[model samples]
Target: MTQDGYYAVQLNSIEIPGEFDISFLTRTSNLKAGNIIFDSGTVMTMLDTDVVDELVRELTDFVSLPTEKPVAPHFKLCFAVRSTEQEEELPALWFGFNGQSGNLRVGPDKLFVWVSRFVKCLVITGTNDKVQVFGHITQQNFLVGHDLEKMELSIIEKDCTKLHEP
Candidate 1:
């Protein structure tokens, strides 16, 4: 946990490549090697305002879906979809952490939310604050373990509904 009472991880890389083109985040070198606060109490992930602006531009161009005005005040990225089931059409985001062997891949379930019958909004928002927050909405279905002594964080995908089925 950080001194501010939030669990933090060394976020190094963010991947969202285009199969036929280069990565959408190729020019976002400024976002690398930053600490992101992992707070379970917050429902939406919040990145730096400038970072979010760049991401919004890339995602808007990458996703073929029609755009929608934000349903919520906190978010600027949204799309008009027939149903949440179309999540597969959205790109998946992978976040890499230092000291961790593998990247944490967040699918549509963790990246988006259904605001109305035909509206799906990105769960991540932009914040003017210096701290980048990784919220609970993006941590759903994952088992996150924090090792204070080693100063490391671990995340594993799990079916939380059946954690104690034994």
Candidate 2:
């Protein structure tokens, strides 16, 4: 485990669909890398840029909102993603996190929601290894749960307004 305590799990043959399904493998760090390289806190789960691209196309007219944190350039999408499970969608949800000042805050100001269905990534020079990242997307979407022993992420569907914020 890295400093933050994320267990590197390798998922293979994952299917990402938006009418057309793409098969690929994925890795996460929650931080940049890990003990050997770029690392941060645990509970790292990231989606590919290809997933982000798909969301942009499928979820047309997505309202772009301004963010205080400068994780990525340009505006971020402020909405939660859901599978067409049934007639009713999940409720709103928020990710509660300690701010830079150690104070907790929540919503359009604190977090932005993004889905894997809206991302795309191509080959960049020297990037023949694999596309991977800790990501602002994961940080914005999940709430880390730790008991000084085990760490896990739970899905919240309270408001689903943005990410985690009041």
- lDDT for model 2: 0.30
Residue lDDT tens for model 1, 41-98: 8899987777777778878988888999997788789989885555668887877666
Candidate 2 Cα errors over 4 Å, as ranges: 1-46, 61-143, 147-151, 155-166
TM-scores for all predictions: 0.85, 0.29
How would you encode candidate 2's per-residue C-alpha lDDT over 1-166 as one tens digit per residue?
2343443222222222223332332333243432111113422323355544453343333232221222233332323334333202212212122222121222322233332343321110111224333333333433533332443222332334555575
The per-candidate count of clashes, in order, stands at: 0, 27
| Cα distance off (Å), candidate 1, residue 73 | 1.7
Query: Top model by lDDT, which number?
Result: 1
